[model samples]
Target: MRSNFRVALIAGSIVLSQVFAVTASAAPSAHPERSSLVEDIRFKVEKFQLDNGLTVILHEDHSAPIYSYHQWFRVGPRHEDPRRTGLAHFFEHLMFKGTDKYPGKKWERIIQANGGSNNAFTSRDYTGYYEDMPSGTLELIIDIESDRMRNLNMKQDEIDSEREVVKEERRFRVENSIIGAMYEALFSTVFKVHNYRWPVIGSMTHLNATKREEFKAFYDQFYAPNNSVVVVVGAFDSGDAKKWIKKYYGDYKKSEIPAETSKKEPVQRGQRSVTLRRAVQSPTVMVGFQAPKAGHDDAYAFDLLSNILSNGNSSRLYNRLVYREQRATSISSWAYTAQEAGIFNITSELKPGQDVDRSLMSIYGEVYKLRNGLVSEAELEKAKNQVMTDTVNQLRTVSGKARALAAAEIIYGDYSAVFTDLDKYNKVTREQIQNVAKSYLKPEQRSVIRMLPKE
Candidate 1:
């Protein structure tokens, strides 16, 4: 089963630049220049919307006989009420339980019979479902997806069974796992008011208390044509795909979009700390600071700063703490951006008997240097290049392109933001990185969590 915990964790901090281009044959362009490649991608992408507020994006690539279909809903853990946390994530699993027309097991059986695979995941900001199948099965996929949008049939028994599954998932992912427990503690400490303080998997207490009627209410409110975007990529005719979408999804009525939460997290006045004693062999340290939201101006600089600090073997954290100082077995940093403000976290696993305080101080020393404008032009360029290369590599697959487009539309409001944001990274200067470091990474604004082995 796909879980939102990992997706939200990774997407929250990572700024994946959606960049690249492949020819109609899905082969790399022969020119090998960035400008030419970007233009090629711009030419291939097509987007349109239906009358009922359903947005559709299509990218035609006849290189392979396969394609990926994705439906992204703009609701996730962030949209859930604090009293009923994890409802959005619960629906991620519940969506597959089937509708009246299809019935249980029928959805998965039909897809597998057609040589296709389908799965979905939830995150803080969105929940998405996708299927990878041969080009011939596009209509079938559309038919099944559209039917379930307004017709999901959830009985009490199925709801109770899936509630147990989600509870077990929370046990395995958050309660039992040390790192998972640590992350939960860190977020709870970091944001006192924001719904993001809770894990997307939710708490067992809330999961158990949630009723069938509550689930239906959530489904009716957020799962509407207006709140969704359908993205189709790979080998398909755009005109035919549009016609199929109209036939399947055109008549679904749009529901009232929920008003966003107005609660704001108050600024942290002093450092907050937590310690967890779990069954583990090694100790770990995670230091997190509140940062700007996704698509915020400061977010781009923080993304580049995260890369410079710990992206590779040559990064400051890796070379100083993990290699040269030998205080840590591993060290890394991430800037998780969301619809609301996010966290910029640095995590380290220390070698046996290493001093956690000393290691944390060393990490702080590096961040302080960045705040002092110590980053060099070459270092900035190298980090940008690393991000660019990683972005291009991820976009190489059809599934990856589909995901990028969906994320762009969901998180940034325009599918073109995926391409335009590449320039934001390219334009980030050393001064901007230092300024963000100073503004956001202050010690008093940080939340520190240490997980130690229970003796």
Candidate 2:
């Protein structure tokens, strides 16, 4: 289970009109009768920095006697050397290989024995490991997490074992899966030089080439107090939790992460497309349009545009393609904003005999409508409501709260931006949505990947 992960294409970000973060639980649910989701969401977080530079954020939720511990690092595929490629994700595998104190699966066993669950995920922008356990075990979590952060003992045998595990993960996810392969290809075709061109799971060749020393050096540089954020949400004495955090995480010296340097992906000049054949039952297609980074004035509009096109069966693309024409088995879209450039993506699994070019035409037909015509007031309002509802759901749980907060801090560097999200979406005029579609969704700016059954 640890070998598997889901790519955070959205980078735990754009939670823009998406409204994600350390939020939710205000004294009164914003008067449902009232307008303004902006005022509707809120959170109280206490933040402190350790002497060693570990930033801690605590949100006390006494509603349940449980807490979610999320440790986020400013390290992921984005920080990886193009040659070393998967090193960021490689550590995701290594981190769990265990420290001398909790060697092997004992670390997982200890947590499970204590009635808690733990897992981790890698993304284009960052890596996050989390544990959800009863608040009673807070100190236990801190002690063990801190221990592994500094004392992980990685031997060549362990590294080799984990490498093989990730290699299989890539095979299963990218090499074998149709939708998976299309998504991976979409990034590569869309960017010429950006690190985003690579899969978060990474390529098998680089995984094989990366050695133990490279892994050790990466761990030493990225897994430091100065490079990570610790967020705890749920029932716990904020004061006691702070003390435990200092005792467990303090003392470790910060590492000197070299100044990050990566060439900006050169501007994409024209439409790009790739056709890949796979042993699949149905043809699949994905289209990606280069868009702005998260926190861009335009990111929110792109997100709303995505929702308007794919939020449900009634969405424009779904209504036109699936419900009406039956060209696709299913359809979806995303405006994935990240620390770097973002992509506005549309994906569809087509009927067995659907013509790929015809499918592309049908999909573009729906998109061009938004570019040429403004969405109805009612339709635009519905998209805003859906975006708000999703954001509210993101705020409903402590884990959701941590992700939103951590994303805001790490991706945008301002936790408070979370509070303004609903208003951001609310203020997006219909014209802004249409204008963004016209500006970013041009054919020259698009990259398409289509997968067909092995013939």
Candidate 3:
């Protein structure tokens, strides 16, 4: 799923595009007692496991009469074989086609009758489905979700139709958008061994080649109760929620989930680059560096450094490249974290007739200065404040809190990390930031993608 959360900056007259999913928004002010807030949030959360190995997490919020119910499965594009790249994502669409009990359009009609909305998204690491409904409708959503989890009746015709729908989605999102194409190219060139090298939306050839049996095998393998997490947030009683979860999900049997033995991506020994000629208005350059995994200590420092470089107009890259030099129209930097190792990326859209080489040098110069410990104490403080404030803002929403809890559990193996991670960010020192920059942001460890306007 593409994350709705992002931290952004505007450079000169141009606005930088958001570089990462799972980012935070601007906050009113930094909360000094963030630990208390974390504790408060933790207190409201209730977690338990069902006999069938189904994991359930619940959060009660009486402020509103609405709630969000989400189910996150540990299957995504990363679980697919190289030849069958898009099956995981394609199944996301097929899931909505309905089971025998619910049938076509029946599930959606029931949700609409109750004035609720439902949707799902697939990412490289997980697939998530959620429903936001008025509090009274929680049981209804749970029943529908639980029914489909084990009883989905897939038809050959539905698969055929949805396959085309996925193809059209790819056409709109990746094939037609310059930035989208650049993102695909960036990962493809960055990793040689990992499945992350492929986009979440599988290629047209693979989608067309997939068979119905393959689809059934995938569903049976990864969609088991043991391989998923169920989260419910908003106005609800924890006890009632658990009872409902057990009633609907307890009887489902856990299947034998297979172990993932994908080859580990080897270390990069030199800079890699790819050039794409797209029909666009301006030339865009994207640079990526191999970075630490999500739970790693240095990831926090990298996150802070990304904010310092491009979180706002006052950021280093915005002021340097957009205002001071006026060579680039916009620039953004982000450290993307996943279940495995992540990518730290910087992207710039250059002005007409600007020197790409010169812009690259200017950006690298600023980065090298960070390695040299030129970051002042004030700048470091500002970055920290932004990170903390963003965290507070994210926790303010029910869906946001639920997503954080689910992602933390699925990706990091600890839901408490959702709260403790802020402290990790707070503990990051200027020295650590400089050290990470020196260690990972080296010339040989980077990849460059230049998208030139097609002649």
Candidate 4:
């Protein structure tokens, strides 16, 4: 889920300049380069489970008066019944609507009056609600969250109203957005059996058809302590925070959850592609190649592969397709690290009058070549260092640290997975990068989508 976990950006304009530095071989280390100065990474965490089986992690950082509160639910669109494709996303919006204990909009008003900010997000694997506010008001924050979890008041009027809001959101985020449209089409065609094919924001068609009763049923099924994690980070005492948490959330009943193991996708027999036409500015192509999930050993190498290919302007896809080949105006790629499975995406926004098919072929050719040839040790190190720097910087901010720990604990089953992840990354050899490519980057494993400008 997008959640409140932020990927912090430090002052790296100098590093940004080297975005077009991709080469047939890696550059020598002797080239003058300056590492961005980063703050110390430190967090004091208290981990425990409540009587009802709610997992909680608290990070005490008194550096500032503000704190970040997050409640991450393990269940997301993956757990949703196929009939309720967008229920998770819908619930995300409705959570802000008041509950029985705190009726009307008074709950949010109370928090805002106390100087706080809040938002939530839904992904394929998780839905997270979070708030950032002054540390002194931590109890109020917990109170608000606890009330909503157990005492949500879902009136038929509110449900009908919010459903329309969700439909409009889909129109804005999916129907109108070109890349968003491409993402939906690509994933739908790519994953045969996996629930990943369904977009988290859900289908407007399904949302409109959903009954009020079904929405309440969805809330009961997934919104429980057993499937959630509460993370509070910033200036606070862990002991006091835990005491208040129990006082507020201890009464929430544990609900029985269904055993959830879904059928995995079979090996790809061949390449897949889709086309989306809309009133867009330029022709765009999205290419996806299936890869291992986040914790899989291959995930680290795939991440490095993404960094080398398209992490920044200096990366291969950008430098080659945009600057060197001049195939399109801009080119970029992303290695999406989702919960269960992932994809390496190369996106090219074509130059006016440029051939989209030609650009797509050239980009695919580079990935194919990488599979056949081993990347140099120098290239591998460059990618590794780049990721390390980003990771360290992400942990520097208080909010960042909290999010890192929270995501690690909820997503990977332990906060230590964050550090362990780095260790695994450090052990990746250049050969492993080539191996993942050879195994996962075959042309047949790809799903290509071209979003063309409306005629």
Candidate 3 residues 12-123, lDDT tens each? 0000112223333553323434544345335467788887788888889888898888898988887898888988888788889889889759999999999998888776
Q: Given candidate 1, what's the lDDT at residue 176?
A: 91
Task: Write down the TM-score of every candidate.
Answer: 0.92, 0.93, 0.92, 0.90
The Cα local distance difference test for each model comes to 0.81, 0.79, 0.78, 0.73
Compare the candidates by lDDT and give the number of the best one.
1
- Over 1-455, each residue of candidate 2 has an lDDT whose tens digit, in order, gives 00012234342234532333312242223223446655568779888889888988889988888889999898888788888788888788888888888875898888889899888877788888889998788998898889888888989999999999999999998887787888888888887778788888888889999888888888999999998999999988988999899998988999998776656877677989899997788889988888888778787777778778887788888988899999898998887767888777889899998888999999988888889999988777676666666677777788878777777777777776777767666778889988998898987888999898888
Residue pairs with backbone atoms closer than 3 Å in model 4 (clashes)? 19-313, 19-314, 20-314
Each prediction's total of clashing residue pairs, residues at least 3 apart in sequence or on different chains, is: 4, 5, 2, 3
The parts of candidate 2 lying over 4 Å away from their true place are 1-36
lDDT of 4 by residue, 111-203 (tens): 789888788766677777888888788888888888888677888889889988888878887898886788788778778788877887888
Give per-residue CA lDDT, model 1, range 124-186, as digits (tens).
888999999998989988999998888999889999999989999999988898778988898
- The residue ranges of model 3 lying beyond 4 angstroms of the native Cα positions read 1-41
- How far off is residue 37 in model 3, in Å? 6.9
Better of 1 and 4 by TM-score: 1
TM-score of 4: 0.90
User: What's the true lDDT of residue 239 in model 2?
Assistant: 86
Clashes of 4: 3
Query: Candidate 1 has what TM-score?
Result: 0.92
